[model samples]
Target: MSAAGVDSAPFVRLTAVTKRFGRAPPALDGIEGIVRGGRITGLVGPDGAGKTTLIRLMTGLMLPDEGTVEVLGYDTRRQPAAIQAAVGYMPQRFGLYEDLSVQENLELYADLRGLAKGERDRTFAELLQFTDLARFTTRLAGKLSGGMKQKLGLACALLRKPQLLLLDEPGVGVDPISRRDLWRMVENLTEEGIGVIWSTAYLEEAEACDHVFLLNQGRLLFSGPPREMTARVEDRVFRLSGTDGRRRHRLARLLEREGVVDGVIQGEAIRLVMKPGVTPPLGEDESVASSRTAATPPRFEDAFIDMLGGGPGGRSKLAETQRSFAVGDGKPVIEARGLTKRFGDFTAAADITFDIPRGEIFGLLGPNGAGKSTTFKMLCGLLKPSAGEGRVAGFDLRRDAPEARNRLGYMAQKFSLYGDLSVIQNLNFFAGVYGLSGITKRERIELMKEIFDFRPILDLSAKDLPLGLKQRLALACAVLHEPEVLFLDEPTSGVDPITRREFWTHINGLVEKGVTVLVTTHFMDEAEYCDRISLIYRGRSIALGSPDEMKSRIVREDLPDPTMEDAFIALIGASEAEEAA
Candidate 1:
């Protein structure tokens, strides 16, 4: 099934496909595309951009309102059963029975795919090794970490070795190492001539594919090689970093306002895109005459930002009313001493200690089962620590659980906002529960609407909003009463770059007003926003510091330049090695 052997046939093809969801708009508007044999094609776009709709059309989960879709030369509408039999489809929220063990999940998928018992056993062994799940076969799928769940989901998908693989944001919430492993598996499949159409919001991951289709607001913006698409914006990006935030912010504004820059905020630096002939602004004491021209090629992320009409500049506004809380002699908002949680003989959270300062953004980072959620639960007073002491917002976590819970806003990893309720109704319900009433409740609701741009969807049901908007509404509900501290577990998990940026805007505004934030995220880029971070591995804080401090500590002197990903890999790898020893 090599590309050379199947050069005569396209693995999957779509012709003038259009799908409409009621009268809102066509989710897949005239999406005419083709996937060739032995190639990895990326469907890249922001959330609600029709990537998922296109995938569904090809997978026969939904038929298009117009046109046709074909898989392996079979019409999808007429031959959905044949297409399903020949394709491996993994949706965004994969269906995995929580109660089933890893092995059982794979076995069930194998049986469902109609694999022979012997073939199933053989494939199961290979898949276990490939996904690195052999060690955890007895562990329940629900007990697995976020990365592990994704790996298991893929394992189930690959059980039958279908001719075409359709993955929808397969690496949405996975760690960097897991993502790398998943990509390697995908490359191997494509090498074996199994065509892949991967829909993802992660632009960097999309760069690995052989071809890319850029979708925007249900329209195909560009289709072809990633290199060609990036070439369109080459020599336009300038990397700017400095110690001063005020100066950097000022320069960013100037560049943005001049209409000559395509800027993206990256940690402490600003990646600015300048016009072909424009000169960079010079400081009074610093000379611009000796400034060298930036020759670096545009990254997929840079190109994406340019395509989004550059960054949000002065036009963005911050909330006016201010609420302040003192750290009380700079004491940590949350403090844990020798905290422990165990389920029978299994240790969910080992003896751990940490201090989170008031008005500071603290990041809780770890692999899926690395004790992040357990610790978060303890802090929020949902689960009592098996041993030791903890406090949140000046209330002892164990002794004053109710008091701590009331003072802190908790947004779970799987945020379950009332879908049937209208946006305003959801807000109102949360507001009432938080003790905000009369004009106070009304004022706060209005503030949230303005801050999150929820006015347009006030009367719309929460379930009707897109993923990004849902995340926004969830966040709005969480902050309705303006809790003293916020506990956000993977708040931006699965959100696209644009939505992620917007979410951070609201977060940064809160930080500016001295609202303490304790968040857990799998996305490394978000770790940059935290004032301090603790890298938890196997229920312990193996690394802790500001992003720069952590980077400096872990990066090797031999390496020319190391990124956050490199630092993370080094730290986590070292931790695992020590545990083995």
Candidate 2:
């Protein structure tokens, strides 16, 4: 059911809603939207696109400063309790007890919903089967992977079998397989007349929704089916390809030319988008000119990029830094030999081994709690390896731990920025900790502000900034001392596609200048940027190869045009099959 014929009433409706905090500009201004029953409405936008604010208004957590907000035919301000009782909300950072077992958590939520014993038992069994968590019912919530935790949170939210469900970035930081499982669950709910309003920074997720409300800078840009939006750039997208090892340089050149709306290296080719009423540039590089390219249908992200303005004007350029640590001539900059980590009798990472050469982007791909973090911590010298050893920039991880740490930079999964401090203060403090002072520190701070476009939010507390701005702040602090190696743990997990592309642009520039990057990401599309990847499953590196190599190795006759996500799922599925056998 769409907004067209919904019994003269929407499940929830917002009319010219406006909200503000303090003296700052309105967080949401004059927004109009509706959520219909038995449909998935995606609140899609970038970091500070007012998605969360809209959700709060719908749930009656906050009253709009202007206009009216109603849910289930009741005014949010007067009937907040009634609305709250009927809607199920799962926040970005869900409230789940770390120490509580999955079964216990379910019981707690069931009790909160005041369910009888019979109802509780029925609900628990249904949820367990739906979420595929029956085998792990006794496992603590904290011990589950990021995806499992999300499923558990969803199960708890469904204890009351709400009429409407609201999920805020539930797929953030979750692996592809887990994301698929969660979506399937949501799809099942919609069939039961459970309206779902999910907010996401991911464009792909927004594409799957029945309707999309594109919000940006507190304003609604468009509201309709995703195809209606993507249709704007239908025949404008093209794929250009050439000889191997030259795609990046060709992509950089294409982006520099005028009329080129957006260009990215997709697999072995460059996906190009042209501005409206504009043709592909003539007399360009041979790789672009002589290539036999054809127009393809635009993806949701392609239209999103065009809608935001057809150019890469807001991206940051690579910063100038001293290259004192020379790349080991033909030798690996990072080496892991039989690395292992164990907690009690359970091994988090067992006998994992990989060698990363200088200037290469090495990705550690896996589901959450699959030992990617454990192996990362050991490699970075934060946790001692239970067995074997590794080397970082020529420093032995187990021997010269301090030296190893100093030679590299580490960005945690959740940014480690000082939330209480202003952006400038955080940069200054990180610089000081890195031993820079006086003129050197000032210059470094200024450079970071310029590169990351942080001047606008300089005085804002780190916690108050949007997700993209916070990402920039965290990256600036990480590279302050210009370490030879950088470790990014799920850096672009929750960010929008444009922000992620911009982040990788800077990273690519750095790699060209001899910086080695070790990254862990849930976005399979990002695997294309890495020179090589290791797919980890159950504390083991099951597959190690380049993106193309791995995808090609998956001998699945069923899947044509196999992608990184397909390859990853295939490998994990195979591993599970072998273990069962």
Candidate 3:
């Protein structure tokens, strides 16, 4: 009754759980944890870290190979049906009838739960108001945006008002605004004394949870409050500023130094996570000497990475001679002149114009349903624009589409790798498609394997690899031929911070070698890495400038130190108001 003899009783508890599949390591290696009512419990880990396996066990979808899982004071193995009835579960891929309307889906779920007419009506109205889907009740669930569908799934889960709720990776593939709204609703539910178990790949979400259980490689590394975990690295973090060279140069220097655990560009400074009790090193380089290093507070991410034993060599340790860009009188590598795309009665992109200089990192950012993707597709020659012209690498996109594609590398938002093929097989196939033959192809494949440190997983199938490794494989294939320009659409979406930093480090290395990059992302912090960014909303480029420039434009006196995210929200709000008028 009391979590298999624990002193303090928990609403749900796992005692010495262990699960394994095939010849691989155990999915849950003797894990012990608890979930209490009236608080949000966060299960934070990278993809394939047993977060989903544990969630399934807790919800009675799977039984533990060893030990016991108790929920609501009942053993899950003995009484799975009782657990299912008392618990509301929303998996990563929620099941909602795509052809049915929003109201119809809610009605179906309510009837399945055997809710009375009065109860169903009251619950339906409440869900509609809370999820902000009241206006779209008649709309088909399939037609809803990704965020709306997630909300609809959540509403369906809450229809019965179960005592315990389980949400598995709800923020995956959703935009920032939708993530914020979903968290707000979860918090409100916790206030009503309903227990919640939330699993996520995003570490930042852990700060909002009352308790956190960190899993990695099927082991429970830490389990406690967020502050307690973050405090493990207190006074070890440092901020270095006033560097003289480019961001990559500074980052490279920091990574090269000893005692520097992790370093990343943070606005006008570089935040370094150092080893315990290690002092900042004094460098002979002028850029390093001029920098002012001071101790700073540690973030949750800092401790998490430190606990996991440092990142993949902060900024790519294996250095090579980088290709340089000639900045003389030459046309920009990418250009869009009055580009417009229309779908029947709807305009996806309208008169969008922008230019990306050679070797520059250009960012296209906006909320879901915005025109960023449309604009990107047109520039990549995937779609023929309804009006105007575009060019890439001095080749006209429309007439010279073949030549333009040869000079470019593109990674789509979706997982584009061959699933059935092994890592090396995918690499070979992509290399051949890019026209690499004989020694050149073999040499390039070897180089990519070294660059991404993908040698160990070469024999593994692409579908079985972890999400981070899959991303690396995709990027490696995209740039195998060393194209002049690279296009990334939501490249870092739904990835952990450490993996993102590693991916950006590779991108920075390419940028240093004169590779022009155009990227689209939802993470506001990533915008700081770009030379300039264009924010698209309602099929128009409303703002285009550096991250600092965009932040400076926010003149609201009530707000203090407005971040890039705040500026983006303000700009989009203004654009929406104008359209309504």
For model 2, the superposed segments whose C-alpha errors exceed 4 Å read 1-9, 243-246, 277-283, 286-292, 311-316, 320-328, 555-558
Error of 2 at 127 (Å): 1.5
lDDT of 3 by residue, 1-581 (tens): 11332233677989999999989999899999888887889999887789999989988999999999999888988999999889898998899899999999999999888788988778899999999999999999997877899999999998888888999988877767788899999988877778889999888788888899999889999999999999999998987778777767678777777787887776667778888778767466666777898888787888998998776664553225334566434669999999999999999999999899887899998877788999999999899999989999999998999899998888989889899999999999999888999998998898888877889989999998888889989988898877889999989777877789889888887887778999998777787788899999879999999887888888677875677778888888888888899
lDDT of 2: 0.85
Least lDDT summed over 10 consecutive residues: which range in candidate 2? 313-322
Q: What is the lDDT of residue 372 in candidate 2?
A: 89
Q: For candidate 1, what is the TM-score?
A: 0.91
Off by over 4 Å in 3: 1-9, 116-118, 315-330, 555-559, 577-581
Better of 1 and 3 by TM-score: 3
Q: Cα RMSD for candidate 3?
A: 3.2
Cα lDDT tens digits for candidate 2, 1-581: 53333444588888999999989788899998888888889999988889999998999999999999999888999999999899899988998998999999999888887778988888899999999999999999998888999999999989888988999989898899999999899988887778899999888888889999998888998999999999999889987655434565566667777788887766676778898776666455565666657787788888988998864632336533545445558889999999999899999999999999988899999988789889988999889999988999889998899888887888889878999999999999999887888998898899888888889889999998878888978998988888889999999878877778788777776776678999999988788888899999999999998888888887566875687888999899999999999
Model 1 residue 49 CA deviation in Å: 1.4
Evaluated at residue 438, the lDDT of candidate 2 is 91
lDDT for 116 in candidate 3 is 88
| Pairs clashing within candidate 2 | none
Check candidate 1 and list the clashing pairs: none
Q: What is the C-alpha local distance difference test score of candidate 3?
A: 0.86
Instruction: Evaluate residue 338 in candidate 3 and report its C-alpha lDDT on the 0 to 100 scale.
Output: 99
| Weakest lDDT window of 10 consecutive positions for candidate 3 | 1-10
